[model samples]
Target: MKLSHIKLYPLAIPLIEPIKMSGETITHANTLLVYLKTNTGKEAWGETSAAPLMTGETLGGLLQNAKYLGEHLRGLDITELNSISMVLGKILYGNTSVKSCFEMAIIDLFAQAQDTSVWQILRDLSKNKTQTKPIPLPLLRMLGGSLDKEVADAALYRAQGYRHWKIKVGSLPLAEDLERVSILCDLLAGDIVSADANGAFNLDQAVIFCTAEKTRQLSFVEQAIAAKSTIDDFSLLKSKSHLPIALDESIHDVNEIKYFDQANALDGASLKLIKTGGLVSGLAAALELQRRNLKINLACKVAETSLSAAATASLGFAIDSIPWGFSMSNQYLEFDICAKPLHAENGHLNIEQLNPIGIGVTPEINLVTQAHSKEYSTVLC
Candidate 1:
């Protein structure tokens, strides 16, 4: 099938609550939703979330790049999917989220044409060994609000079978943060508690905090230092601290995996479609990390909607080993704009539910109508 048109929808969907990180606070999900149309009247949807702190992509930049990509993608034959990706890679640089958004739509449409799911198509194309059946993945709940609020939230999620919890540190005072983590570690005695600094701590502070006895209960520590810190700094922290390190903000290109692996700087990596560009690229990165025996934290953008969450679920299932991560963005959203909601049950995402053709869900008609009425929708051909 040949591409006929590409429509971009810019949206500011509200989150259930503001997500405060080290340097930023997110109250709404500023994202771009792309609708790809084929000459045969088939349609596929994709989504890209903009996070300036994480991916260095602002809302305005994503919209511009989405329009530019749509202009360049017209008349490209969807059958030659590799060629489409190559063309996108050459058009511009660093708009990973925008590139991923289009790639998702293309893959979604291709799966629909083949009467299969994105998971099946990716697995069939993959050279790595993957499971034949969907494996249930452990979900990581983000600790929100005050310590009392977090305790209450953790208790509720714990009752629901969630074993992994991630707390946002680096924004609070060291004493308060340590106290909060200690309380959580005690409350979740047998479960995993990870502290993500969002690249807020310096090497010394990270080393100090990570080496503390109170923080010893953590399953791992993520992005403790700044994203701009040198590899040597991470290596030093890795050597000095007992906690296993997982790189999130520091990982963008797949090449970084080799660098970190060589330096022994990290024991795990967080793979997100917005950071890796698309499903195909993200899966490739995950396979490489698995080959090196590095743990994979398969996650989503903080304020993602159901479209990307559905996409993440499909990709996670095709992996040879299910990573200890969460694709539960829909649960954090006030409401998903999809006709079929992709919700997790009992703190686990059952991959079997995402086996439907394409990305497993379609946009809600009313959501589309609202975007158009608000003049946030654009058609480029």
Candidate 2:
């Protein structure tokens, strides 16, 4: 069936509690949700969340791009996802977040049309070895603002059955960062705690923090230095620190993977679908990383709704290769605008089952209506 209509909803959902990262405090999540309707009357959902600081795409820009994408998508065959992705990629240079949003919606719709989950679709597409058992999904915990807050946050997540936590670092003074790490270790005991620097640190600073005698409990350090830092610098940092490093911004595409390989820059990499464009590219990156025997951390954007979450869940199941971010399941802490809450049990999220002919869930009509009304009045989209 061909796509008949598409709609975009730009939303700002306030967080119940503020989430503080290195350079900013996030009190509300700003995101765009995309809806696609087929000629056969099937509907699918998708989400794209852009942090102006991260991707440099504002809400207005995202919405405009969504409109442009929607126009191109209209009249396209729903099942030809790869062709659609290629055509869109040729038109849009680096707005993978926008492209991914549309691609995901189409995939969701395709799966629903078949009355199956995205995982089943992916399993059928795989040429590699497939495991028979379901992989256990991991809980994602964020590192809080201060040393005391980090400890408290870890304890809070642990109480809720989370054993893995990711702490934010790099923005703090070296001494202060170590102090927080110490506190986190004490609170978490034997639990896993990874540190995300968010590309805030320099190579020397990252080396010092990773090698510091007081910081020994870290599972890995993520994007400790800016993406511009040379792979050689990462190699030097890796040599000096006991902790392994995971590349985030550093490995954006296949070419970058070769660069990292040549430089021996990291022990692992974090793959986000938006960064790589969609599930297809993200999976390709993961498989390549696996071929190199490097660890992988599958991550999601903060503003993702259930549509993107379902696709991410499929990735988690298909890989089962590593523990990664799946924090949307705990939206009570993060703030979610989706009508239905994502379900999590014992720190694990069961994959959302997509209806065989379209995206399983529909957009929250009231929220979308209100957003569109505001856009009409404000000329936002």
Candidate 3:
């Protein structure tokens, strides 16, 4: 299908509740939604949340890049995704977030043209070596906010069949955070558990935190240290670690993936569409990680919509393994733009049920445009 036009919608999507991280508190997700129209009169949607600290692209940058790429990429065969990604990389230096938005939209468009669901296409693209037998999804749920909230949410989610968990850490004193983790680990015993500091700790702090007795039961620790960490730092962190450690913010390209794999620094790497730029590159990164026998953790930026959540979840069908599980951030949203939104039931997202065709979403234009509560923050185009 020929790419005819592109449009961008910026919305400040509020979360159901504010989730506090290390330094920042995310109350609303500044999301940029992309809409693509093919010359064949087909439409598809893509999503990206502004993660300046993680992806280094702000919401405004994503908007401008979308317009620029839309103008340059018009009239081209969008099914030629490789060529499109090449042009995107060639003409631009960074801004992977916006590029990912377009690439994701293009894949949705391509799948629609092929008269198939995105999951089928992505699953078919997986190599035979990367295929895996059916396994239960250890869908990851984060424990944020006060200890009361954390404890209450854990009990609530446990009753709902959430067996996998991540304790959001590093904002409080180490001992207090450890107490929270200890309480949750005990409360949610016999469940798969982990802790994520979101790169808020120092090397020394990371060493102490991972080696702590309370964190012993954790399945893994993610981004324990700062983002500017070196390979040696990660290696050292892993050396002191009693449990497996995964890298999130430190990963951007294949080199970082290879460096950590080669150095035996991390057991898993978190793969996000914004970080990989699109599903094409995301699959490439997944294959690379699988080749090295590293754990794959496909995630979305916090508080994204169902479109991104569905797109990210569809990847589970293609990957070799998701030992760390899926973090589809749409669950954190108060409202979703998609007419039929995908929500997790008993901890698993039945993606096949959602996406009978194309990226599993048919977003309403009105809802898409008015995603923000404040009309001024909503972009018309």
Candidate 4:
């Protein structure tokens, strides 16, 4: 089948609660959705969120690039995903978030054409080359607000069976951060705790922070130093610290993996489809990290709809090495845009919901119809 039509939907859904991280707060889902239609009447959906601070991608840029990509995609054979990906790489350099939207759309369409899930597609392509099975995904919830508020939230999540927690530091003084973490750990004994600085600390501060009394109690430390911090700095911190150091924003490509491997710098790496440009590339990076014995964390964009959540869950189901847990932000959305929403039960996401065709969940027709004013569609010549 050949490419026949393309539609773009720009959605800005309000979050149920504002997400506080990296010294900022996010209150809405700034994502652009794409619907790809083939000549044979097969169609699939894809989405991308704007993270200007992380990936240097904006909603405006993603929308423009997606429209431009649609122009180039006209009449192209739908089955040649590699060809499409290669051409996409040539179409723009460093607009990875934008590139991810088209990549997801093509892969979603391809999987739909095959009457299979995207997880199955990646499982077959994995290095193991074996049929993959769905597995339970343990989730990590972020801790925010005042110390008392954080404890309250943690208590609620703990009751929900969430055992892993991530507390953001670097925004507060080291001593206060330590005190908060210590209290939380005392409140929830035996559960895993991680500290994410969101690249807020300097090299010296990172080392000092990790070596502190309560900081050492964490399961791991994420991006203690800034994203632009050198491998040398990370190596130095890793050498001095007892806890494993994970790089989130620091990881952008597979080549960075080699850098970390050569220096023995990081103990973990976080993977997100939007950051890696899509599931195909994200999985490749994840497998390589696994081969190197580094911990992997599957994360979803903040305020993403169920469509992206379903895609993330599908990937989580196939990959068993992601022991660091997933950062699923579906709970932050006020009203999801999918017909069937993805929810976590007792910290474990149900695998059955991720078994649908293509990327799993379908967009709610009523919501899509209501958002038509935000949509731009064209029939490719």
* Candidates by lDDT, descending order: 1, 3, 4, 2
lDDT head-to-head 3 vs 4, winner: 3
lDDT of 3 at 262: 86
Tens digits of per-residue lDDT, candidate 4, 107-127, equal 888888788888787776674
List residue ranges in candidate 4 displaced over 4 A. 129-132, 369-381
Ranking of all predicted structures according to TM-score, beginning with the best and ending with the worst? 1, 3, 4, 2
Please give the range of 10 consecutive residues that has the lowest summed lDDT in model 4.
372-381
TM-score of each: 0.96, 0.90, 0.94, 0.94
List of clashing residue pairs for candidate 4 = none
Off by over 4 Å in 3: 129-136, 373-381
Output the worst ten-in-a-row residue range by lDDT, candidate 3: 372-381
Query: Can you write out model 3's per-residue Cα lDDT over 1-381, one digit (the tens) per residue?
Result: 777767778888888999888867899888888788889799888888889788877777777777777777778774564676887887677788888887788888778878887766777777544444324345789889889999999999888878878888999998998888888898988787888899999999899889988878788899999878887998989988998989999887688899787888989889998998888778888888888888888898987888888778777766636878888787888888977677777887664446677887778887776685453343323
**What would you estimate as the lDDT of candidate 2?**
0.71
How well is each residue in 1-381 modelled by candidate 1, as lDDT tens digits?
Answer: 888978887877778899889899988778788988999999989999888988888777888889988888888775665665687888767688999999999998889888998888777767645546767777789997989999999999899988988999999988788889988999998887899999999888899889988888999999999879988998999999889899999887679999998998998888899999999888888888888988888888887778898888777777746555864666787667876677757778787666488988788858755533243556564
For residues 122-217, write the lDDT of model 2, one tens digit per residue.
655555457575466775767666566666766776888888778878667878888888778777877767888888887778888888877788
Which candidate's lDDT is highest?
1
After superposition on all C-alphas, the RMSD of every candidate to the true structure, in Å, is: 1.7, 2.7, 2.1, 2.3
Q: After superposition, how far is residue 276 of candidate 4 from its true place, in Å?
A: 0.8
**lDDT at 376 for candidate 2?**
26
What TM-score would candidate 2 get against the native?
Answer: 0.90
Compute the lDDT of residue 307 as modeled in candidate 1: 87
Distance from true location, Cα of 135 in model 2, Å: 1.9
